[model samples]
Target: MSSVRRIAREEWRLWLRSKVVVAAALIVAVLIAVTSILTANRIANEQAQRVEQQVAAEQTFFAQPDRHPHRMVHYGHYAFRPPPPLAVFEPGVDAVTGQSIFLEGHRQNTAMFADTKAAADLGGFAALTPASLYQLFLPLLLIVLGHALFLRERESGTLAVILAQGLPGTKLALGKAAALLAVIAMFMLPLIAVAAYSVTLGERMLAAFSLVGGYFVYLCAWGAIVLAASVLLTQRAVSLGVLIFVWLFAALIVPRFAINASSAAVDAPGKIESDLIMLAEQRKLGDGHNAADPAFMQLQAEVLEQYDVETIEELPINWRGVVAAYSEAELTDLLNSYAEERMRLEASQSRIFGLFGLLSPTIAVSSASRAIAGTDLATHHRFLRESEALRFGFVQALNEKHAAELDYAIDMNRNADEAARLRARVNASAWQVLDEFRFAPDGADERLGRAGGSLGILLAWLLAAGGIVLVAARRVRL
Candidate 1:
């Protein structure tokens, strides 16, 4: 144990004396700090702006003159997803998933204005969010620190001297691993600080802590893999090249391939297909234009019978309002069904990517990070589902008001003059009565549980790498 501690100390001293390692560590730390500050400020500003726009849009919608409830449903409402508090630590899929979604009767709109798909390839590479930085660059830095740890010692004939001093090979390997872990700690400090500060800003403290923990484990895994490769290869240059190849494959090639494979496997329906299918289904259910249509006429007859009125004129409730309510219900059902189908498809695609986590720990880390951030595909689907529910509730409430409050006598018969006047007006107060959309962030425990399986894959990889390192160390000659 004393010898191990002495070796760890010596390795640390050696790392500090190496200008390349010191400079690389400093650069990475600065980049992390800069990214944290920039992302925090940018996300805060964007969210504030979105809130203002939503309020203004709501006010404008309600300020208009009174109109039929059905008209308001077609007019639609917009809900902007609020950015999560820990977004600074891991932007995750925020850029890939659109922030604003339109909610309306008879249609389910996909969220729009995604930053990821909007940018050119160059911008994609240049964007410096936490996920991008860590996923693409951090492993390379780990490789730089780890590739020479043992290989260089062997190359310099120092291993024989150390072995002659009676140090066990496994202990030496552990000491070197400990030294690399220290460098990993340094690389992770800024992110940990960012996570700590996120708690004070009303972020989920436990989730933020878990994010930091996950990142630490991820970087340590990279270091371990690099160390194992260094021990396996006899030439320092060969070890460096092999480690770079490993980093490239794990970090870049594998993830891109997984995404492509998932995309190809499921073939997610494009927006056009979804829109056309929904339109066709809506028409099949009941187009308001054909009041004489069998479905509409049957609904009208049922509603009249329910009220025990022989004539539509004698009905206590406004018949038009009743028709609107029935139609809205049918529309909601169709849209919800279509939305669920799309969500299922997307989930299938994500599952394919999740399976790749076993092959590349980077995939596992990326998946875990996004899940914790609440900006992954699953969260986006949830937001869309909740938004649609809210839309249905408000639209249905307005439709019911049309049936209960409006006098059927005046509303049923339409003279050209009265029709124009009615078309031009509605109770603005009705709009004010509708609830605003709010996105609830998932609880820390829920997020941790969702990400737990992926973390298990990562841990499994680490243990496997550790085992390999053990075998390599035991086989080392002098």
Candidate 2:
């Protein structure tokens, strides 16, 4: 181990002395700093902005003047998803997914204000973040700097000299791999600092650690592959070319192919189709407001008997409000049924992509990072589901207010009588009692637990790749 450290130190010095390598390393370091700072600041600004928007939405909802309960329902609400605490470190799927949703009566809305869509609207590309810099680019940098590790030693005739000096080929290869790991640590420092800060703040610490672990294993895997290629191949240039091709195929091409294949494998229902189905299902519930409709009349009769009243006019409750509440309950069920089905299908697609991780460990690591950070499709679906729950609760609160506070006479005569219209307006304070939509992210432990299998695959790849390098190093020829 001491000899290995000495070898690593000597090789690192060689890297430092190479002007071209030094310059490349410096550029990569600068890029890391710039991306870390810019991404942190940008994500923080967006988080604060979303919080402000949420506050404004709540304030506006509760500040409305006296109005009919149904009017308030139509007035609607806005809900925004605050990016997860660790999301800036690994934004994952949030870039393309929408961030905000509008909640209203009789309808479900897709998340709007997506950064990807906004970028497209602006006629420019979406900016890449530090996550991509870490995941995609840094590995390529490793290939550039270290792909010729063993090959260069062989080419320069140092293998015989080192072996003749009593150093084994395995130790030489391990030493070079160690040197590369040391360099990789420099590229990883920014992420380490971020994760450390997250831990101190007690913000998704498990997920943060899991994300860091996954990346560590992923980079180690790349190091192993680079070293293996350098030793197994006959020439330095060919080694570099082979590693670059591997990086391109594994990191770039295969994931794209896997995504295309997964999309084909799953039948994810589109938003429009899901909405149409929900609407059709809701329409089957009949005219809830029209008490003369047989279905509603039956409901009205049941309610009248339940309340021990002979007519709705003497029922001491607004029949319209009762009908609205019942209708909303049924409509909400339909909404959930379709939403859940569509979400399940979409999740199936994501799962299919995950299975493709076997072909490209990059996919496995990427999925693990996103899943652990609570920024994947699953977390987004959690947000949407929770938002719907909040909508139901808030809307139901209003409906209950209508039942208790609204007069049947006023509701029945509002369109015909101005005085009745004025009387139909409920207290604005009613909105104040309802809670705003708040997204409850999955616990770090839960996310970490869920991401364990994918992380395991990354570790498995690292181990397997390292084993290959070890075997190759053992058989290196003079």
Candidate 3:
């Protein structure tokens, strides 16, 4: 045991003395730091720009002159999905998904703008924020540095000499693993610091903690796998090559294949198909503009009767407002239902990829990281749901105001001069009274519960890999 410890210590000293290894480690560390800073800055700037545009658009829409309440319904409103606070760490699927959606009466608009997939092939490689760097690239570095730890010693005839001195294989493997674990810890320090800072900055502490915990287990799994490979391979070159191949398969090939396969499995309909389907469903409900349509006229009569008026024009409530409210409700229902179905498809796609975690710890780590950062597919779906709700609420509030405050006789009759006047006026104060959209952050307990499953998977992988290391130690030959 003492001999094994000495050999491990010597290996660590030798690694430190090697200028090439030291330089490579430094270079990777610098790249991680720079990438994190740059990504954070870029996302912050983009968010600022988006907020400005959203505010400007909202102001312009509200500045419009009063028109038929139905006309205002058609004008609709835009809802912008804001970037999550910790998005800089991962960004995840945000770029792939649309960021802004237009909500109008009687029509459901597919979200528009922001498609990361349109970028060139190499774009993914360079999009190495903290999560990608640690979850994808750092494991490869660990393999490179640690894969030949035992194999090289054996190849060079050092392992037999150390073992002849009564050192057990288990001790030798554990000592080497300890050394490699130190290297992994150093490699992860900067990222862990960033996560801690994020927590201090009011990001969910539990999410950040989960992010760090998942990463630790992921790196440890890499170390264990490398140790096992080292013990199994008789030659240093063979061990290194095998470890590299494993890293490539686990980190790159398998993940890409899973994504493609999951996407195909679900057969997610295109935006156009979604929109057209919603439209068809909506037509079944009475269109507000079809005045002579018996169903719509009947609804109008029912609304008038409910308000205790013989005619729409005689109602204290504005008939145009009432019609707009009903129309908005029907349209909102259609959009919400369609949106939920589409989101379910996306969630299914994610689950398919998640099942591949057994083959690739990279997949597990990436998924866990994004989940904790609130930048995964699940988080994106939540944003869409909330945005849709806010849009409906905003539009409905305006419709209700039209119903309660406007003069029904003038609005319903559309007397030429009166109609013209109504179309040209609305109080600015009324527009100002509309609430601005604000997204609430998820609570700590929610983030923990959400990431718990992914974290458990990663820990299980780590334990299985560790078991492999134990098996390798027992069977290993100098």
Candidate 4:
């Protein structure tokens, strides 16, 4: 322990004497602080903006004057998925998946306002966020700092002097690693502070915990990898080159390959294909607008039979409204079928991507980060599902109200009689009876459960890397 402490102090003193290391460390600290502040503020602003927009959307939806209920269905409401607090650290697929979806009757509209789809005038690309620094830059800095930790001693023939002085290679390796750990801690201090602040948010507290815990292991693994390479390699240049190449391959290149492979192996329908398929299925089911269509005629007959009425006039409820309700229910079923298929495909892709976690620790860390932050594909899917449920319920309620409130005489004669048309217009107060769309985000327990596998993957990498480092340190030679 004394030797390890002495060597750690020795390594620290050397770094202090070097102006290059001091400047780089200072610059990295400043960058982390700046990025953390800016990203957190930006995410908070966007989240608040989405909440305001959602309220406005709801207000506009129900604020209509007396009109036909079907008009309200077509008017539609917008559902906005608010960003989670942990999004300040890792926004994940939020930038690409869009934030707002138009939930209307008959159509499952695509989400809009994706950052990637922005035109040049609309802010062409996403600015560098804090997550970018954590994923790409910090590891590179660690690599550059520790690439020659022990290799430099070997290069300078200090390894002979140190060994002759009776210092074990393992103790020397442990001390150099302690120095790297201190440097990594400096980089993480700002991020940890931001995460601590996030813990004040309800569900994100646990997410912030996972983010902090996962990254701790993740960055330490990198330090171990760097230390192992330095101690094992005889040449300083070779150690630096090999470590940099490994970093690039694991962090940058392998992830791209993993995504490509996952996409290819899992045959998922694209947005265009999914949309076209949904439309075709809806068309086959029936057109809700055409009352005289054969499909509608059958639906009318079924409702008449169900009500024990010989004719539309004898039915207690408006037959047109009944048909409208039935049509919506049928269409929603089709939409759900397609949605489930799409979600299943996505799950397959995620499963395949998990395979790459064994090959690259970055894959596991990225997955764990997004899952805990509630910004992963799973959360987006949950948003879509909740929005859909609300849309179907609201649309169905309107359709049912259209049937119950309007007299059959008014519907039958509305085309020719102005008085009947006036009678068919339901009161605007009807919209108030409907419930608002409220999406309750998953709780901490759910998020922790979802992120567990990815966390395990990171832990596995840490353990494997630690084991290899011990072995490498024991065998380290001049």
CA-only RMSD, every prediction? 2.6, 2.2, 3.2, 2.2
lDDT of 3 by residue, 1-478 (tens): 5655666678779888988778778888888899888777766765666677678768877786755544565677777776666776777777677778886666656667644433562466536677888887788778778878888788889889878877788888888988888888887787777777676656887677677777889999989988888888787788888888898899889999999999999987766788877776777776665444554687777877788878766777776677777877876787777778888898998888987888898888887777777777787677788777766776687778677766765554565676555553345445543457755456767766766777788898889888988888877675
> Residues 1-478, candidate 4, lDDT per residue (tens digit)?
5988888888889988989988877787788788788778777777777888888888887788887888888888888888888888887888778888998888788778734322552563345667767777777878878888888898899988998898888888888888888887777777788788677644466667778888878888888888888877888789889988998898888899999999999989966689886776678877787666688877777877899989889999987787788888988888888888998898889878977988888888888888888888989899888888888888899988888998877877777877667777899998875566655457777887888888898888877877777888787677
Q: Write the per-residue lDDT of candidate 2 for residues 310-385, one digit (tens) a residue.
A: 9889988888889888888887888888899999999999989988777777888888988887889999898888
* Model 2, residue pairs in steric clash: none
Candidate 1's displacement at residue 260, Å, is 2.0
lDDT of each structure?
A: 0.79, 0.82, 0.75, 0.81
Q: Which candidate number has the best lDDT?
A: 2
| Candidate 4 local Cα displacement, residue 43, angstroms | 0.7
Candidate 3 TM-score, true structure as reference: 0.90
For model 4, the superposed segments whose C-alpha errors exceed 4 Å read: 114-127, 417-420
Quote the lDDT for 326 in model 3.
80
2-72: candidate 1 lDDT, tens digit per residue: 87777778998987899998898788878877877877776666666667767776777677667766678
How close is every model to the real structure, measured as TM-score? 0.93, 0.95, 0.90, 0.95
The global Cα lDDT (0 to 1) of model 3 is: 0.75
Provide the clash count, candidate 2: 0
Ranking by lDDT: 2, 4, 1, 3
